[model samples]
Target: MPRYRKRKQATQRKNLIGSLLIFAVLGLVAFLAFFRYELQNKQLAYDTETLCPSNITSPKYVALVFDKSDAYNKIQQQFLRRFFDDFKANLLPGTRISIYVIDAHNNKEIAPDFVVCVPRTGDDANALYENPKLIRQRWHERFEQPLDLAINGFMQPAQADFSPIMEVFQTISLSAFPLGSETVPKQIILISDMLQHTPEWSHYRGQMDFSKLQKTLYYQRINTDLQQAEVNILYVRREGMEKLQNKRHAFFWSDFIQSIGGRVTLIEKIDG
Candidate 1:
């Protein structure tokens, strides 16, 4: 009877050891599962769009502003407000917008918010341009897309005619539709004052060799499609920028716009 009891005791010890080992394994698996879940959530939260961070240390937001309001000698200031709000909305959410407003005629610098952030408030330095570097860095993971347009000279007949507007754009896209560089432009927006006139269509700036510009545009265009990148032209004059201004902006901009996959909207008259 004592021998039988010893055998039963040994069996119970073995059973207890097996049960404890099984529980330990189960506990370890649960902890590992929970830890993995937490890590995945952390990574996911950082990799997507969110509200704009008031500070630039965060990695996903970018803000760009071209304040043409220096020319707003008259129109209601609220128009400028609408223009900015519309611009902010057009950007992907959680984007930070840095603003730069240049005096329409004198080239005087107007610091909307970057008053203390820059060395001197003028075109002499890109401090105005530098303020947005943090945000631009966030786009480095994507391909670089170059965008060029006549930001200053789309009005004169010779200068405005067939502006090598696509040169910069192609420079960034030849290898990939989107070029991935920490500071390269992933998109392009042209904000223009819509008053354009071709004084005399006789001689052309074609006398000017934009081979460099044309080359920059052509090669990238070979690899990229005008359809893929989002191009927005914010015209200070919505009066008929993409429609009526075509006679000067391009040979037939209405058609070019269709071919290129873009839409034009008036950015409120700043020159009135």
Candidate 2:
């Protein structure tokens, strides 16, 4: 009887040891699995751009939005959203560019990505749209000039959010970028109703006073200088009532596409 009891006690100890080993292995696996999950999530964070061979090396594409209309100033956010939905992912293969959507009036970068919905904050759109030379200069210096200083100063104390623009600039700054291509494609997609009312024109055509605009030709004409860009005017289409107060941004963005150096397509969608 004593020998049998000793054997039973030994067997019980063995079983306990086995269970602990199994638990230890499971805990290790669970820890490894959780660690991998975190790593992948960090890897897939929102990237402003992805690389591909069809790169144009344009100075860099800046998604410019102008929320300057007092008439639609409160509702200007709609246009910015529509712009993002149309082109954010469907962008041409190999085409990578940095994006910036600004409250053109305030010069504050309101949206960083393909943001579709934003509340309106009425402010005049500034014209320092996307010229690298202008960006390099001190923004406050822009106000010191005798020009429409009132319309041109920065709304917030921050200088400028050129990080996206600068990243591309550094990437392409190497030996002639888009390596084989002799010409670099440069563009600034200005999204606005093309309205300015500063009472007079400054030498810089796109700058507006934001206060003096009349509803007629003042807002009708977009800055014509886009003709100078290597591949200018990746234009988006817009049309809707001002009082609607919601971003009626059209998802049907077919009109704004151009090859690295190809002629700008002037396609437009007719509302059915």
* Best lDDT among the predictions, by candidate number: 1
Candidate 2 lDDT over 211-250, as tens digits, reads 3332436333321222223322322323543322122221
- For candidate 1, lDDT tens digit of each residue in 40-62? 53332232322223323322222
Candidate 2 Cα deviation (angstroms), residue 242: 22
What C-alpha lDDT do the candidate models reach, one value each? 0.36, 0.32
Q: Which residue ranges in model 2 land beyond 4 Å of their true spot? A: 1-13, 16-22, 29-33, 36-62, 65-266, 269-272
How much is the lDDT of residue 91 in candidate 2?
40
Q: Judged by lDDT against the true structure, how good is candidate 2?
A: 0.32
Candidate 2 clashing pairs? 58-185, 69-73, 78-247, 104-125, 104-126, 105-124, 105-125, 197-212, 197-213
